[model samples]
Target: MEEYEIAIIGGGPAGIMAAIAASQNSSSVVLLEKNSSLGRKFLLTGGGRCNITNQKPIKKLLNIYPQKNFLKHSFFTFTNEMLLSLFQDKGLNFIEEDEGRIFPMSEKSSDVLDILTDYLDDVVITYNFEVSSITDDFIINDKIKADKIILATGGITYPQTGCNIKNYSLTSQPLTDIKYGLVPLITKEDLSDIAGITLYDVVISYKKSKVKGNVLFSHVGLTGPGIINLSNEISQGLDYNLLENDPDFDIEIAIDLCPDFTREDLKEKFTNDFQLKGKTMLKNYLKLFLTNNFIDFFLAQSDLDGEIQLSKINKKSKNRLIENLKRFAFEITDFNRDLSKVTIGGVDLDNINPKTMESTLIPNLYFAGEVLDLHGPTGGYNLKIAFSTGYLAGLSASEK
Candidate 1:
């Protein structure tokens, strides 16, 4: 048996960081990955560019997480700034994009992976080592013995990338009900005509949750950051079984296509345009605000004619148009679990120590990343959580 001070399972972002952190403390660390290579999902982040972290202040950054209170210690211990500084010290420059999203200067997720792997020089990395068991004595697969074990096996999302929830029962701890997070939603209405159109800075509101981001119209429904973030909020308390059994289940959401303007604002603009361009066709005049592809659809939904003169528009039709532009409603029916960016449920947080990332039920056993019921919205928040928790788990394990 190969014995080590620390054995980290699952070579995703969290496991890799755990191995690096443990090795830095002069501990003999071994990283086991099920895949042939490390970071299969990591390489696919940000469309392969890899959004590493956000540059928001620590206080503001913490607000993005649902489990902000539980993550307070780990996030403070290893912040986005600290992570950026570590990469910068290794000669990897970064670029900060909109919404404080930070990416590698090379714009390659492979480059980010290279910088992370460089820190594992002293760590033993075992590829294609799918661990099936972990004994109470801290023996992994009855072959590798370690004083402490850190589980960073991620969640059920992206199962093709080696995320198997069934394979995560190495410990007897209870797992929470799982739900899809940051996934694109399939709407009841077929949006195939506007499939390729993208609405910028659109506001999607479900219940009290309102998220603003770019919304990409898909053949099936809605996607992109706007709808994806809103999907997270809508998926709360919804388990896989409930969703699977209820095909008719749907949630109504209102999308503000013109978030920059209110109903009155749009009405005022329409009134001025109608008076100034009385002879102009409604379809031609609409080109100033909406795309040509969407004008016909909008006119049909409003029960108005595109060929109608602007001055010929009636009050009822004008009001309906303004209302539809301000609040376009849609019913979200389902989301593909395989396409979810993160999973909402995992090893219960109540059984884990927030400060150390150590399991309260089992000694010397720690949990990190998406395995611990922690998740955040897209644009680098989830990756930040993975790295921060992994670093804390490894650091605490090494000290023990």
Candidate 2:
């Protein structure tokens, strides 16, 4: 068996970063990827443009993950600005879009992938290599020996990308609670007719939890970053107990169509509109606040006649209309059937050092990326975690 100083498993951002960092000073390193090509999933992020990382301030960037304190060392070591600079230093230009999302100037994920892979230089890349098992000494498919190994195999989010369903530490490590995060929800509302209707600046709330973003009507259900955020928060066990007994609990989230305006504020607006334009058709007045399809559907839900004059509506009916407009509820049956953005839980943070990402339980066993239990919502935060931790792990593992 050919032994190496370090072997980084999985070729995603974390593994690739690990290889780069490990080989910085001519340290022997090998990257094993099961896929025929590298970064198949990386090419799918941010609609193929690849939201490289957020350009948020150091303060905001540090608090993005659930284990915020656990990642303090890594985040500060390889910050958002540093991550951006790393790419820019390589002559790769990027553009800052909405929400501080940075993307390649070419606006193509392929370009981003090219830049990342180019950094590997002389690092050994073994494609189409799958390690069937991992032991104390490190073995790969009964071939190469990686004395010191960094497990960067991502979770089973995009299984098509070669992520194994088996949790590597199920037997030894206790906390490997895996669930999908940052995925679009499968809602109970059938807005097929109103599909493609976008509600800007809406607050999607499930009980005490809430997220604000544009909500898009998908044929299957609700989608968009706002809904995906709620899904991530929910998968973290925030509202997971709603299904404890039944295991198929139907949860409903309230969509505040107008987040800036309060329920009382909307009531006043509707009441005043009814008084001033009493002769105006209710449908026409509603058009100011809602989409035509929404007005049609909401008007029916309110049990009020859209064709009738606004002034003709009674006080009780007027209150009902205000409630429907303010807190429109939608049943979330399940998560997206299409693809899960990130995997939620992983090897517990307690078992690994925050500074080095090296396992406290087993010597020389390091972990980085989603496998480390550090994850966040979409828009480049998760990728940052992968890169930062991988850098630390690789640098630390190379040490004597």
Candidate 3:
């Protein structure tokens, strides 16, 4: 049996960091991964550009998480500044783009992975090592023994990236009822003609909760940051069984294309446009506010004619158009779990010690990454959590 000071399972961000932190001294730390290479899923983050972390201040960053208080210690231990400094010290430059998402200056996720693994020169990394079960006796793969253990197996989001590990009782929660997080929403209404249209500065709402950001009109429904965020909220509501029971859970999503304008404001704008171009087609006038493709589709929903002259437009027609422009409602039928950015639920936080990422029920056993029940919106928040928790777990295990 191969014995080591530390045995870290699942080589995603958390496990890698755990191994790195544990192996800082001459301690024997073995990182076991089911995949052939490390950071397989990490390569796919930020549309393959790798949003390494956010550049937000620590206090602001904490607000992005579900349990801000729980992550306070870990974030304080290894912050976004610490992460940036580590990579910059390793020759990997970063660039802050839209939404304050920090990415490698090279825009290559491979470069980010290289810097993370550079410190693993002396560590033992066992690829294709799928540990079936972990025993209290420090047994893994029914062969190895270790003084401390760290479980960083990610949640079941991308099976291709090896998150769908099975045949083992790794997490105390087990995360079976997997609902999609940060996924595109499916609408009952198909805006196929204008599916590819991208709208900036729009407000999307489901029930009383609303978020304002960019929205992408997909053939099935809506996507992008705003839509994806609402999906996460809905999924959480479902997990807590709040959807069916809550009287306000209508599942009807509203997109305010002209969020900056009130209904009266839009009405006035259109009324002024009508006066400016009296003989022009309503569709032509609407082109000033919306896309050419959306003009026809939006007109259909309002019981208005695209060919209707602005001069002939009535009060009722103007009111309907304004309403549609302000609150274009779509009945969200479903969201694709397979296409989600990550899984929402994981090992329950109640069983894990937030300070050390160690299991409360099992001594010397730590958990990190998506394996924990912590997730955030689709920026670089998840990656930051994974790295911070893993770092904490590594330090705690090494000390023990």
Candidate 4:
């Protein structure tokens, strides 16, 4: 039987960090991965650039977690700064973006994983060795024995990157309630016609919840960060069904095609324009205020001829146009179908010790990454959780 002080599973960010941390604490560490190379998911993160972490403080970082207590416990020891410093000390320097998102100076996730590999020289790693099962005493490597085990296996997302479906199987730890977060939403419109067109500075709202920012039409649905933030709320049981099925599902999006102008200001401008070219059709008059296609559609909906004089426009028609500008609604039918961007659920947080990430049900057991039901938005927050929790698990395993 081959014996070691620590055994870490899954060589993603968490597993790599655990191996480095555990080995530094005078424990013989072994990291097991099924992929031919380490950090397959890491390479794909942030669209291959890898948003390593956010420049947010510890308190701010804690706010990003869906479950606060879990993050509070795990982050006490290994923090966002500590993780950045660790990488920096290892020669993987990082820079922050406009939104405080941190990325490697090299602009490559591959560089981050390379640094980890260099740091884990003393830690044994077995690639292409998919972990079939785990027991208290050994990892069953040709009947080999391991002293301590750490399961850093990720969740159901990105199955192509070697996600273990059996991660939740045979677990004595309770799973945390998981649901989709930070994904796009599908709408009833045939957005494919305007798929490449982006709507900027628009107010998108449902019920009392609303966000005014940039959004883009996709072939499948609506996207962009604004929509993604809303998608999380919807997937986590926000009643978007009312916006999907109800014929009266009127989601009022104030497309301030000109948000810079108030209604009164717009009305004044229209009055002056009508005075200058009262003979011009309403469509020609409004063409300056809207896209050509939108103006045509608005005119058609208002039951007005494009070439009609502005003097002939009735109060009812003007009010209707104003209403259309202020309250454009789109029916939403479904949520994002991209499974890779979602973490539906994981190990329940109640049964686990947040401080050490240890299972109260089993001795010498630990969990990290998406398996624990902790996730954040599309930022680097999710990966940060994986690193912090893994550090706690490795430290606790070494102590035991």
Ranking by lDDT: 1, 3, 2, 4
Which stretches of candidate 3 lie above 4 Å from their native place?
A: 165-168, 171-177, 239-250
lDDT (tens digit, per residue) of candidate 2 on 253-350:
88887677887888788778889999999888888888777788777756889899988988888887778777888878887734778877778898
What are the RMSDs of all candidates, in order? Answer: 2.0, 2.5, 3.0, 4.7
Pairs clashing within candidate 2: none
* TM-score result, candidate 3: 0.93
The estimated TM-scores of all candidates read 0.94, 0.94, 0.93, 0.82
Model 1 Cα shift for residue 27 (angstroms): 3.3
Model 1: CA > 4 A from native: 237-248
Clashing pairs in 4: 174-348, 175-347, 175-348, 176-346, 176-347, 176-348, 178-344, 178-345, 179-344
Model 1 C-alpha lDDT per residue in residues 1-400, reported as the tens digit of each score: 9999899998999998888888878558999999999999999999999999888999999987778999999989998878888889989999999999999999999988988999998999999999999989998888999999999999878889998866557899878767778998888887888898877887889989899988888899889889899888888835453213432345788878788898889889889989999999988987877767878777776678889898999999899888888888887778855688988878899999999999999999998898888999888999999999999999999987
Q: lDDT values of the candidates?
A: 0.87, 0.80, 0.82, 0.72
Stretches off by above 4 angstroms in model 2 are 167-171, 238-247
Candidate with best lDDT: 1
